[model samples]
Target chain A: SQQGEEDPQALSIQEGENATMNCSYKTSINNLQWYRQNSGRGLVHLILIRSNEREKHSGRLRVTLDTSKKSSSLLITASRAADTASYFCATDEAGYSTLTFGKGTMLLVSP
Target chain B: GAGVSQSPSNKVTEKGKDVELRCDPISGHTALYWYRQRLGQGLEFLIYFQGNSAPDKSGLPSDRFSAERTGESVSTLTIQRTQQEDSAVYLCASSHRAASSYEQYFGPGTRLTVT
Candidate 1:
């Protein structure tokens, strides 16, 4: 069973536009991490936000975590056609080492 | 200096045949993990290993699946008498430490197909 669920299974936007994806989980977590995967390739870690933190930023990516709402969002600014990929959120529950991942949101950035 | 690496980028075998998938973690990385992803689905946790200590095999789906890591470097996942349901992309990942939270570096997974 997957612990996290991402909304908007697919999204499309023009290059240079911003894209946002949301994820919701059912259990309490110690930290949440986001990853990007190109077609038929392994995942690349984007950013990680701890439960105590409200927001985190890395490169052109911004992530927000709201423990109260059991949700998180990832924002990619100045998107490029190269940014077309699937995004996933993995959650590490409190007292657990294994991270559970969401189904993922597929983003298509057009040139 | 390289990231995690898995061998046999692709594998195809008939049903009831046993198969082995190998993964070599980055040098000095103590934590290694394996995941399975079916088409149109998210990655599913399969197993976790920290150094040569006991591995967390709770996520394995059945008794036919087993894994072994030697000297904290290369790891092997073996599926015995595989079934068609066992077909999936098997991914390997490694992390520096298991301090509760750390980013896992993934390898290009081995695509397994059981006929």
Candidate 2:
């Protein structure tokens, strides 16, 4: 399976602190995307980074991809209670739209 | 500018019964995908359709699971003789194309409960 595996299945942090989640996959990929799911419902896309790129940022979110290590990390700075959600990493192959997802990292930010 | 929509936000059925879930993707989108998510689990790919091309059913768990789409408009996922394990949140997503930087737009999802 090209599915990515996220470390620290669960995380807890204070509202003002930062939270970082890591993901490691098994194969080559075209791009990696991060998604957030609230209350186990639909997932909202957060950001995407191409394999050729090393890092990306969106607002308070920072994503880094190291293909040589087959790993990626998501860092949310100054997290808020509203930012608490299950974050997932999905890897897409070169030509296909299919994405193999990781068993997300559940995050909880205390207010 | 409507997003993907699914029907019967929730459903309850008995074991051994058949259930069909519907997904209406964003208009003009050419790529559609179906996923199943068990409680507290990541989304599992079920199938995907790209334009008029043959769908990729490799992710389907069993023969009991099958899906069909008509010209990238609407798609339906049917499960025969459903079991308790079939209970899950069935999600649908759509994109303008299969590859590249296009992000998939997801539907609210249909929650299936098999008693």
Candidate 3:
């Protein structure tokens, strides 16, 4: 399984604090993507970081990738209660079109 | 523009019965994908269609499961002789094009319960 594994299966943070989740993959990948799923809804794409790129930012979300370590981290700055959801890191393997997903980190941001 | 849409948001079937779940992708998206998520688990890639052609069906767990898409439009996933293990939320997503960089839009998903 080329599936990535996310550390800290669950995270609880205050509304004004930053929440960070880490993901580690087994094999080399072309790109890694982060997605958010609210309660029982579909996943919403958050950010994508390519292998060549070390870091990227969108709105209040910052993603960092380290190819040598095959690990990626997603940091949500000043999280809001609305940001409470399950966050998953998906990897697109070097030669595959399908994205392998990790178990995900269930984040709970209290307002 | 509408995002991907799926039918029968929830379903309940008895063991040994067949179930069909439907997915309607965003209008012109050329890539459609099917995934399954068991309770409290991550998404499991089942199959993907690139313009109606499924280049890889390797993620399918068994021969009892199958899916088909028609010309960048709708896709249906059928489970034959469904068992308790087949109970999961089936999710469908579509991308403007295949590969990296493009984000896939997902549907609400169909929740299946086999008893």
Winning candidate number (lDDT): 1
DockQ of each: 0.74, 0.70, 0.79
* Superposed model 1: Cα runs more than 4 Å off: none
Candidate 3 backbone collisions, by pair: none
| Per-residue error (Å), model 3, residue B5 | 0.2
Q: Give all TM-scores, in the order shown.
A: 0.98, 0.97, 0.98
Backbone clash pairs in model 3 (N, Cα, C under 3 Å; residues 3+ apart or in different chains), count = 0
What is the docking quality class of candidate 2?
medium
A1-111 per-residue lDDT for model 3 (tens digits): 637999889999999999999999988899999999998569999999999999999999999999999999999999999999999999987988889889999999999
RMSD of each: 0.9, 1.1, 1.0
Q: Looking at model 2 chain B, which ten-residue stretch has the lowest summed lDDT?
A: B97-106
lDDT of 1: 0.93
Model 1 residue A58 lDDT score = 91
Per-residue lDDT for A97 in model 3?
81
Interface RMSD, every prediction, one decimal place: 1.2, 1.2, 0.9
Residue A28 of candidate 3: its Cα lDDT? Answer: 86
TM-score of chain A of each: 0.97, 0.96, 0.97
